[model samples]
Target: NCGTWFLGRLQTERDVARVLDGLEGAASAAGNALDRSEIGTLLAGLRSRVFLMNNAHEEGHLLFHTRWAMSYLRGPLTRKQIKLLSPSAPEASGDAPKPAKSAVPTSKSSRPVVPAGIEEVFFSSEPGTYRPYLAADVTLHYLRASHGLDSWEKHVILAPLEEEAPWASAELLDRGDVDFSDDAPGVAEFVAPPAGSVGTARFRSYGKQIRTHLYQARPMSLWRCKSLKLQSKPGESKSEFASRVQLAAREERDAGVEKLRARFAKRIQSMEERRRRAEARVDREKSQYEQQKLQTGISMGATVLGAIFGRGGFGRATTAARGAGRVAREREDVQRAEEELRDIEEAIQALEIEVEEEARAYLAEREDKAAELEEVVVRPRKSDIAVMGLKLAWKPD
Candidate 1:
């Protein structure tokens, strides 16, 4: 099952493997994809919740967690490692896989060479990629027939430890077997928002590997912000000139985003108002007619020409006509309003997409412009050590 908070008693080995492998795989594949700032905010809230749970208990295991809870901890390093012993030379650009054998060193080079055993790991600094190691989480709960109503022990692991770390190295803050009990519920629950948000969240279930719904960012490049300055005024110091350029770039980007938002704000508001009014009109019409028709339909008609038999055929006919008219009009008005609302909604969505695309384009253009303003001089004025040292000082005695 899905979206369940209680992942009841799990006894199968398959369940344990599913939760661990699924989360690791997700973390590896989603390298550098999630929004770090937003994720940090959410994780902070999760920590707070965990803190409350831990405080509820007096001792034993301070954390509220099951045995399989370890899967929620540190994630495997998804980044490619630079091996000290490879048969082939390392590639200059992207990270390359290690060769079967170490390559022969043809010459002494400037790059530092690592000695025999230790390997250099190129860890990515990007958040949500390989950043926090632990890719996703699964909440598990166990219960038995002896338990009373709502008195079952609930387990939630706040964080995970390194997979192969020494048992004595750290205080293991988790408990319970992967599948704690045979009578546990076989489902998990999670919140999955729609696509076109700032960042996407991916998660896997402990019972079975569930392909989680991902929320895609709207593709706005507003986050890639910087100040860019091209030229300096006469007699300005190099640092001052760079600062001025940066300030200008920032102001330009801010103004551009604000302008684009303003342009679409009125249109979006008008469309929403129109949709609301259309729906309200349909509701008003239905209320005035449907209620009366429903009341008449449920009652016995008054006696007419067939009064002796206690049957009023004319009254029945009149009631039928009124009821049918109400149904027909209600259907027509509702259908029309629904159609209008759909159109408005579609229009609003289109505009939103356009805004996101436009924002991305504008930011990209600004970034390119900013890049042109930068000039990095990595080479020194002099190659000799002494001359390089001379250039660093205030220059005169």
Candidate 2:
């Protein structure tokens, strides 16, 4: 049953997915189109937000499939994996059931088994596309109960199908599980039969086998997340829980990011203001220094010219010529200094204006972010929403 909160929750998920999809598409279109600098910036941002230091493997588990796709596109090797399968593969393959093959053997007898140090996964592909550019077939276990509160334990093994990816070990991607409890209101446990028990593992596999088979046949060029946070209660549907979690995560992440940005922006503005003030002071001092130097030089040159001419070492015409030259030189120096002072003043003004603009923007953004955070953290609780139902009134006729 979709509760009153379902609509908003669903919309939030769709919105997030849409945004991530847009990023992925843009990155894909930039196929071999983005330069190293651009890629590096995107990569750096992703790393700061999604990846841990020195842990490239964590990336697979951290971001959603769509986010991963976008990041991959921004990577230097995006183009190579974009064309995983030839466009002209057979339109459709006739129905052919193949033999059952194990993904990761638990017992491990010379066969490929789930490896160590592998955790988290995200895989995705476009709708109606048989292949997934980002592919990982995982096996997980969980529980579902209807009567009362229940617990869910799940294990998933994710494998990337990309040929170029450094971590393409299918063996390592074969298996994992999660152990969770659902005691919150309107929630229950997700229970299933034990392994090698009655029901088919395929059904128990949560359609993983089918997805894996399809991925092998036709490589998909899409993004997906193999790893998902499954903290949802039994009463709550998977889709609904996924929506809420995504929304919560997005809200939290975005708020933190904005706060960081505002903090840094304010800092930058302060620094810039300080720089402008310093520059202005320097310019003023420089102007004064130049004026004094020029005046002193002029005075000295005049005295020298007077002395040279008064000594009668040269004719009257020569003395007058020397005086004119000295005066002309002093005039040019004064003009040049004035021009430089004007330029410095203009630069200082421009910097001051920029600092003011940045300050305004920073304050607005900070205020908006603070309001948003308050709304999320301090808004009315579910009980309040349920209690404060809308009242419908009609005019008496």
Candidate 3:
């Protein structure tokens, strides 16, 4: 019973270890000893049932596992069971299988062929929520079609669930055409009927197994799908392309910064020129003020001498007052020019700071976008068949 429970629920090697620990702890509490060899055998059996594969993508690499259906281990279903589960199987009272009412012909002929190539397929439902049984022939045809003349081997790369990383691995199904047939070692079938009344009616009338396969076990929340090519072009491997993508993103970020700086360059230059003019005006005003002071001193000294000697006294005194007024006016002009220069300098400094901040923001945005970009290669043709429980819909990147 424990073995059966473990087989049904344990999804990872860590889960298996935890189960073993619990079993050992229970045995100790019951005053019984657990054998190491027995534990080893159990682990070996679990390994056979679970498939662990590496997830190689832009995201960090991780190991995740998915268990084969329990039926795979139990052995092939009896002929009677097979007949009952088969889409074309006779009804319970030995009545012939009902013919589909649609004009579309047989299901096999109607099903679309799997496209040839490495396609990044996506699912609308969350992982592990639904597992549908697809026809083995369609999957085999896809593998054969995708395989090259020189390289006839292919594998179905299963990405880890969004929440299954770091602590676990991804799943890999060997796509060898011969090993996935109806009678193959790890393939099995189970009866799964459509859920709602409308779906059931459609399935029965149209013999639409594909729709039933997907909608029967779909989740409440719907998700969008995206496709990315593993290789951008011929002669490029996935890793190489990924590296190139990173390089391209970096280049793009730098170019954006440069563009932004170029945009602000003229304005900054113009402000600096205005500031220089302000400074030059301030200098000219200071020079005029100094000359005015000198003239005022000479006029005052002459006025003082004329007053003491009583020679041209009234005229000299009037000229001294005029010189002093001129000096005061020059001083006020100097102060105004200095204030204008200070204001211009401050404005230029503020503009430079704003440009730096804007450039930093642009760089950050580019980095965030780059992090989300994935390297993908080919777009496989969309098909109705859901190979290994995943109906892959390809969307262009």
Best of the candidates, lDDT: 3
lDDT of 2 at 171: 35
Best by TM-score: 3
Tens digits of per-residue lDDT for model 3 on 1-397?
Answer: 2322233224444655676676666555555565533343334332233421211112111122454555545577899987777768444766757775322211211212222221223222222222222221222111112212111223353322222121133233465522322221122221121111112122233224333422332212111112222224344455565577678777777888899989999999999999889999999999999999999999999999999999998999999999999999999999999999999989988999999999889888766655554432222222433344232222111
List model 1 lDDT by residue over 68-143, tens digit each. 2344535554344333324466557666555642222211111122112212222222222111111222222221
Native-to-model Cα distance after best TM-score fit, residue 128 in candidate 3, in Å: 42
Task: Write down the TM-score of every candidate.
Answer: 0.33, 0.22, 0.40
Candidate 2 lDDT over residue span 305-357, tens digit each: 76776854345446456555655665565566566556666665676576566
Give the lowest summed-lDDT range of ten residues in model 3: 219-228
lDDT (C-alpha) at residue 344 in model 1: 82
RMSD of each: 40.0, 35.9, 24.3
The TM-score obtained by model 1 is 0.33
Give lDDT: candidate 3, residue 213: 29
Question: In candidate 2, what residue range of length 10 has the lowest lDDT sum?
Answer: 387-396
